[model samples]
Target: MTLTFDGTVLVPVADPDDGERTAAALAPLLTDRSTAVLVNVVEKAGGAPDKASVEQREEYAEEIFERARGPLEATDAAVETEIRYGTDVVDEIFAEARDRDVDAVVFTAREGSRFAELLTGSVARRLVKEAAVPVVALPHGDD
Candidate 1:
């Protein structure tokens, strides 16, 4: 199916750099009527000690959103930020996508070695394979 940027989109960002790169890649595609929802999934450790405090993660999420906002803001697309919490990152993204009824889920894939991806279970692969909405994988800045 053809992808259009007139409707709302769910954008999952990993970190500040990822956020900036993803937004840069996606910015050119967005229209004046588009709404870009920047989301950072704070993965919760179920029944285990947390790696970071919730406040720390939320602050980091805000930092991500701030970096991501600039590129999209240069365009006419409306930018919004959401900090999501869940044990499963991909699942949380999908849930937010469904909840928002977004036209698409847009992101730039994070770089990693094949072995690293295997060990970490690539979120990019899971997002494309299991997405309920249209999933757009934009090229990274170097690409």
Candidate 2:
């Protein structure tokens, strides 16, 4: 039998562009019976001038979800949104996926500076290595 993605999918997005790309990439996988949860995690930090309050972060996450949801509007897939606050983004993503009993986790990879990777680690990499369910990382491209 040909393998297919036919259940709930957990999509974690870090930015609006990433969210858009991810939504487009997953469009073909989604069906009338499928469910997709779009999530954005606001990384919590201590004593930072640039840090946004939880409420502000939630608002931003909502915007990201809206951008992501645009591509799925034509599909029959049931869509959902979430905003989570955590220091460990990878853990929170996995927790959310597991809690929702998702069949797969979808995300996109983007090139980052070495310092940025060192400081935040790579959520895509971590999810690929540790996620219990299938992890799908759309190739980095303008598409």
Candidate 3:
């Protein structure tokens, strides 16, 4: 069955480095309210990976998901996992949100994407311009 959500939100995790903390920050923001569907963009670079490489990457991603899935599950919450491949990060994220029928998207950005926004003005200009649901950009602090 196609998942219908009373409280499903999409969180686009770009950095493998900060996925854990990003998910942690989002938990309290959502805990009493809704369930979170975590998405990790594999990023199709248009280059093919051999079967072994593909398996290794998939294994790594699964480990990441298990770590990220915790905070959401604490409140008897549920999550939908999706692995999508796309060229542009924002485009891929928006596509996932649309595909999942999510209500909102929460994105965490490192110092770099944040600086890009500071220079350009929109934290995520594309999503702000054209996402199907509301977009929330959570900026990560620089270490």
Candidate 4:
């Protein structure tokens, strides 16, 4: 059976290490026919990304996506990707999963504590609690 997953962020420093490890862990769990997606959220309009900043983000995203292509392809799984932004991250992630009718979302767990996440207002435990679909939060690490 084919399974679907939601991958968040394509930032070099924030991704690779964590996401790659999580994907590795999930590799065995998915079937050969499974289809996984690397979904990256780019704020449709985040106040402003200035020309240089926009270019920089795109460059970084390109690098991350290129690197991701290899591992996902090796799993004998089809890969899908997307980048969008205009809503709260958690809300958008859950919405995408439901819309895709995927098996679950595979994202990384915040490496910090609840208080830290709350203070940062970044995606983390809130996703697990609020996501309408099944959400798999992988620990942050390289191994």
Residues 50-81, model 2: lDDT tens digits? 48767788788888888989889989999998
| Candidate 3: stretches off by over 4 Å | 1-6, 31-33, 47-52, 113-125, 139-143
Candidate 3 structure quality by residue, lDDT tens digits, 1-143 = 33223477887665455567667767666644477877776756566653346566677678778777765566655666777666566777788888877888876755556667777654357777877788876655333
Cα RMSD (angstroms) for every candidate in the order listed: 1.6, 2.4, 6.1, 4.8
Model 4, residue 48: distance off in Å is 5.7
Instruction: Give lDDT tens digits, candidate 1, residues 53-119.
Output: 9999999999999999988878988999999999999999999999999999998998899999989
Locate the minimum summed-lDDT window of 10 residues in model 4. 5-14
TM-score for each of the candidates:
0.96, 0.87, 0.71, 0.71
For residue 131, what is the lDDT in candidate 2? 77
Per-model C-alpha lDDT, please? 0.93, 0.83, 0.68, 0.58
Find the candidate with the highest lDDT and give its number. Answer: 1
Which has the better TM-score: candidate 1, or candidate 3?
1
Q: For model 4, what is the C-alpha lDDT against the true structure?
A: 0.58
- Please give the lDDT score at residue 99 for candidate 2: 90
lDDT comparison, 1 vs 3, better candidate: 1
- Residue-wise C-alpha lDDT for candidate 4, range 15-70, written one tens digit per residue: 55554655565554545567776666544545654334656666665665666665
Which runs of model 4 end up more than 4 angstroms from their true locations? Answer: 1-14, 44-53, 113-115, 139-143
